[model samples]
Target: MASTSVSKKRKREAGDDAKASFVLSTQPKSQLGPVLANFPSVKPSKSTTFSCYQTGGNAKALGDADDAEFAELPTLIAGETDSVDFHSANQPTGCRYLVGVHDKKTGITTIRPAPVHTLARDVKALKSLEPIAVSVLQRLEARAALGETFGTKKAKLAIKAQERNKVDVSAMETVVDHLQESIQKSTQALPSKEEAQATADSTRLVPPYNAEATVPSEVYPLHNIIPEAEWRTLAATPFLVVGQMQRTPLLPFQRSQWINQHLHSICESSSPSKTNIKILLYISYMMFFRKFAIQSNLGKVVLEEKLASMSPVVADGLLSRFTESARSSSKPQFTSQKETLLLTHMFALCLRVDDYATDTELIARDLSQSTQSINTLFKSMGCQITKLTLTDLKRLGLPDGAAGTKRALLKVPLEFPKPRGKRRRK
Candidate 1:
């Protein structure tokens, strides 16, 4: 009976050893390799009843082992337990673990191991690897949390910004239109007759006899000079031409004469002895021209014409005279043909629209009064005026009939006078 019992015990012991050995060897290489490498010297403790072992400050136990070789068994079991813990700990939580069976005949090696929270803690303690592990986990979590990719978020933001820009552009256009209308109403109320008579009297006191006194004695046909039928077309919205027409007399020629007279008077009165006269003249010219251009029908009509009609030669000559006057007046030199052209063009365009001349008589009257104000301002600055050429007039886009007449009067063939012989030494 004693021999049979010992035989039974040995058989059972062999079976358990076989099971543990098979588990350590037959498991997948990915699972077993790291486990064995990290805990190669694990050992079982003497006080433990089961196959208990310590590895990396962690302990694990298998089945009880009575009368076993504790001294050698501790080391063997420790090594085995560490191997199992390492391999099992690395497996995903959902993966099945093979903890029991030994042979292929049984085909039942798969067994679930108990939760190994301690091994997980040990893995976390590896600071060097923690970042990589955390990064992988975070990526997985993020993928699960956010269904959309980074590109989608960027596109959404870009679309929102574009929508905002469109709103701002529309608001700006509305504001511009409102300001333009207000200017028109204010310009209609200016005093017309008083301003025109004042301008005429001032001109009589200056050189280049006033056109009213010098023109052909035969009443220049004033009939179609400004067609009555064209009055509606010629008149602009009140404030639109205030700066260009200066004041309207319902006649384009009359407006032109008024501007010319005012400018001439300003120039004749300025003395050559004044210091910085050039600077004053330039400022005065700009202020007057800008004001008149803004109010004049001629100023408006000329601007509406195409660029081809603005004779460059005439424009150049007029600019040269403007510059010369500034220099002669002893003022700061004001040069730049481009700036002059741009200002002239803007003035012309402003007057061409009907909005600036809706009430012709009213606008003309306002311009006349404003001209006096403008002249007073210029006189205060001590500026002398210079005559602008027909080319300059053409740049303003005056009517073809007016432009042609002026061109005919101003045009002259270019010629060079013969050079005299050099003087002989005395």
Candidate 2:
């Protein structure tokens, strides 16, 4: 059995002759009594309960019960202050209706009919549209339910069958051809190894350091001398340090790669300048070929032999600058600490020890200076002219043959002396 409840919300306007508005709605039920009553044989299954509530201006609630029979609904007349709600129920199969006072003056009631709802029209429309066949729909449903696991057991066999019969190589051949063409074009556009080496050597004004020789124990005894900041600067042009002083042929890429890997830490720590690159090259040469120079001439080689054999470009530039600075009437002064240090290295190689005392005789002759000025030069470099003894020779790892002879040694310390300040005229 179907049951219904209708509620009316009444609102009164303020005034001695105020207007009132009421809305009648069947709560939780369709208004089907009038439509089903048209068929006299059909009887309503239940009755609808009606409730009226007044809000604003003497708010109160009024309620009543109505029969399921087709009784006429009451109309609201002007000056009829009482609000009533009427309801009825039949079969649960009709559209809803909204009843309102159409004209308060004439006491006429009106209803705006609700749209009819039925599934018959929807079913008819669905029948007109095309739909998947039952077999295809069932297949789609099965695939959705199975997800990724669908047909997985047969996947390998299907793949083998496709590879055996349905294989397509033409597209793959086209892609391979395109890739080959691209690679050929790329190779053609690049410079050959010989040509790249020639170009690099052309701009080179100085000889490259020998990479195979051991770095000097004094300069970089334990680890790299070049600091991280200098290494970053050197990285920009590793090719500059890529050739050999003896003109030994090397693989085009091997020298720089070895330098980056092995000698990166062995480079000198110095302030960056226009001469930084040259200074680094000087340090690298001394570090690598110091043993050769020491062994050959007992470390008494002349400037020409040292320059021509070791690094022509750097030696010539340094000597030119040194001679120019020495000729100035005022006492000699180095432009940079690096220049002074480089000179100290050059002189250190030539200093013959007469029992730990430096023999500056050859160096003094080469520079056209007296032994006293040569001594001053060594002193400026923080070296002490001392006598070389058997114990000292042993410490220096000198050969056994030199044990009987006396030699002069120059002691060069790690840190240089601070340059003396110029004295003011009194």
Candidate 3:
């Protein structure tokens, strides 16, 4: 019985060893790769696009009553600067411009861009007409001077042309008077009559005006956005930007927004709406004499935001540009590189916008190379050097209310204190 049991155990052991050997021989070789089954290759459909929260989240107001697509983008959140995407190197420590949206709650002033469509005044269309209006004014003034020496016939013809183009003599006179005063102060020779004649293009259309006060629609127009009293005050004097100054007379970002809103109106309207042309000539004039600072960090931010939002192509182009540099390549997207790029681009664009500046590329090159300071750049462009007046600061988006008013007031001390020697420590 013992001998039979031993033989059975031996047979069992032999069978188990044989099975192990067979499994070892059947195993895949090192080069045979992974043994797990491969998933079927997923062929992405051409029409499909990937959407994420931060990317394609904003779709036009979702139709359903229950569907609440957030209407407002949250303002810069607390500790947003700590995000992995934020690169602080070259992030400017201070901004040149004083204009900012002051939050009364925390007393924090942020670069909170105001909607350009507000103020119900068509500053954009007006802005476009300002130069032509100026030209008509120049021709009128020239003819008027010549009419004094020559005859009223020439001046009459010029006035007729002004009337024909729909240019307002009142507004034109205000601007011209300011300009002449500026030229006189600078002691610069006034533009020659022949030069004015050479530059004049009578064919240009003068921007139209709104004679009728608009009734309140679903949206507020000029009526509510600007109080009648406030409008009257501003329109009364209309402190015109007559010449270039080292300081920016008008904010480029604001003007850009206005321009965009105006262009959009032109595209959307079957015809140019009165809304499009209402505040026309004034904006043109302000922009005409406003300084464009190449070295301004604020301008940098504006330019960057503009490029980023314009289209993916522009953003991609910017990325491609800075990515070449090792320093820029490693830094996060929201970095100084963008600021630098934007600042440089703004400077270039400003130079390009000046019809007077023939060598715009050279000027842009010098600025991009850091050979010119922002102050110097604008000064070279013949901008008048002036700080934001109390009126302008108040006109900009500051906090409201009597207490809010004084606290938010951006008044610089009217008088300077006499310099004193340093205090001697006891």
Candidate 4:
């Protein structure tokens, strides 16, 4: 019985020594037993080892989410400095903690210990002395998450103010100098207008923005998912190209070039005329700039009124194209390839503009289809129609209160449905 007590006492003393060796460890070594139990067969790699406070079990437990959180933290190997001993290299006695310093001008990140107070400190070193520890970062994350949850204008402003307060006065003192330097660099980097024009003139085989120029879409329109017959019909149909109506056939590439030219022209012109708006351009504008196009009541009214002027045949064509383009690639259907490809590009842009939710009213008007049909088209692309609450609109940077209006927004998922294979015979 006395021998058994001695053995247990020795084991306890060994455990205490192990715990004492780990500095700044929030989690105890005993807690790692469960983590190791989850993967008992797996062993730590011999090449790499636990650095100081890190343990093999704890390292293994850091999944994708935890890795993302620590992705910004820069690493510094022991070999970089000769001051530390190689025999007991796991702990860097000199460096109690490491800090990541980012240079905005050079776009380079460096890992080093926090700056200590010195009389010969430069502006850069003084700025880097701000207390940006892990605890401070965690607090900032928590505050930001809280503001997002509350989602009020005042909450957002308050959070911003709090963040500003966190910055040291020494750091704030250099902000003006940094801003001026960045502005001067940016101005110097821009090429002169005459030089840009000369470069553009010299680079071209044909004139810039040529309607006859073939785009990649002509070769592979939406990966040839749409029917060739429908594509041929679209190619044969007369349409507008660069402000002129063409009776001759316009290939997919020609139409694409025309749209690009029209969009460019719109950017150059302060106010684009209604007469200059082509069917495809109008649809593209509405899809890609939903918030900008329909934020104001006047803009929405004007846009919808423009749709009223569209001929029945043009509207029919729009409906055919949009429906085909929006349809799932998994579903078997006959469609116009050019229209499908064009709308596919527009949909991609729309998805990016609004994150996941897209407005369908503008495109619905272009299609001359009911809201139900538009919703069905979005659903085919694996999207769900979700109504945006007042808070949602506020969070999205819409006008204050937005007159208490609600919109039926389409929620898009990153993943789409995969085509199913036929079952084998029993």
Q: Score every model by TM-score.
A: 0.18, 0.21, 0.16, 0.21
The reply for model 3, stretches above 4 Å from the true place, is 1-311, 322-338, 354-426
Model 1: per-residue Cα lDDT at residue 163 = 49
Model 2 scores a TM of 0.21
Q: Select the stronger candidate by lDDT from 2 and 3.
A: 2
CA lDDT of every candidate? 0.33, 0.40, 0.32, 0.40
Global lDDT of model 4: 0.40
Cα-based RMSD of the predictions, in order?
A: 27.4, 27.4, 44.5, 32.5
| Candidate 3 residue pairs that clash | 122-279, 125-280, 126-280, 126-281, 127-280, 127-284, 244-383, 244-384, 245-383, 245-384
RMSD of 2: 27.4
Error of 2 at 167 (Å): 99
Of 3 and 4, the candidate ahead on lDDT is 4
For model 4, the superposed segments whose C-alpha errors exceed 4 Å read 1-345, 354-356, 400-426
Clashing pairs in 4: none
Model 4 lDDT tens row, 1-426: 465544444445433333212122233322321110111232223453322122334323322333322312222221111222111212223434444555554444554332111111123334447775678778779879988788699889888887787857676785888989999999997889878755754442211122222431221133132233422322211332343444212321223343444445543456653333333334343343333222432233343454553333433443444333334543222334433344444543343334335566644554445867656545544456666666667666666654343233433222223336899999
lDDT of model 4 at residue 416? Answer: 29
